[model samples]
Target: MPAIVHFEVRIDPERRDEAAKYLAETLAATRAWPGNQGIEALVDDADPCHILVVETWATTQDHDDYAAWRTTPEGKSSLGEILAAPPSKQVYSETLPLGL
Candidate 1:
């Protein structure tokens, strides 16, 4: 079954725009990664400095591999410096489905 991952990124208010731009630039490569189902970046309306990155993957292992890759030199280089704090990540599995 697929899994959902959420990354809560907090940036300095002054650098929010730059962070958003970096996210946009990096998303293409992320989406192209194997096992990635989808990815999205959303900025909080009440708190512009907070950006939420939602990602769906084929499995937990897939997400873990991608995360490990992101820490490598190549991945680190692609990510520009625009963060106030380290991103917080959480993983979830769909236990119950509500018909919409």
Candidate 2:
């Protein structure tokens, strides 16, 4: 089954717009990455400095591979110095719906 990954990042208030633009420019590559089903970038309404990236991957290993690539120099170069704190990530699986 596909996995859902939540990535949360806190950007400096002054750099929030830059951060959003960066995501917009870079996420197409992410969406094109292997095993990536899709991704959605969201910002907190009450806290614009907070950003959330929801990603769907074909499997956990695929997400792990993507993460490994992100640590490379090329990947690091693509992501400018926009984060106020290290990004946080969590992986989740869908729960079966309860029958009424």
Candidate 3:
């Protein structure tokens, strides 16, 4: 089954643009990942400082691989500064019936 991952990020209001820039660059890389299906980022219209990143993958294993890769020295070095705080993440498996 496909996997859906969501991450909620709370950033400093002053750094909202910086955070968006960082995500734009990072998500570009994710979009090219082997198992990545889709990626989206949304900013809360009412609360500009809050951001949500949603990702879809071919399978759970794909997300696991991505997580491992993210811990690598190269990845950490690139992603270290953008985050204002640790992201809250969740995983979901999609279920759908045919012929909606």
| TM-score per candidate | 0.85, 0.86, 0.84
Of 1 and 2, which scores higher on lDDT? 2
**Candidate 2 local lDDT, 1-100, one digit each (tens):** 8989998989877777688678877787788889999999888999888889999999988888988888887665344478888889999867687997
The TM-score that candidate 2 achieves is 0.86
Q: Where does the lowest 10-residue lDDT sum fall in candidate 3? A: 74-83
Alpha-carbon local distance difference test for all models: 0.83, 0.83, 0.80
Q: Could you tally the backbone clashes for each prediction?
A: 0, 0, 0
lDDT of 1 by residue, 23-67 (tens): 878887789889999999888999888889999999988888988
TM-score of candidate 3 relative to the true fold: 0.84
Whose lDDT is higher: candidate 2's or candidate 3's?
A: 2
Ranking by lDDT: 2, 1, 3
lDDT of 1 at 60: 88
**Superposed model 1: Cα runs more than 4 Å off:** 77-80, 94-100
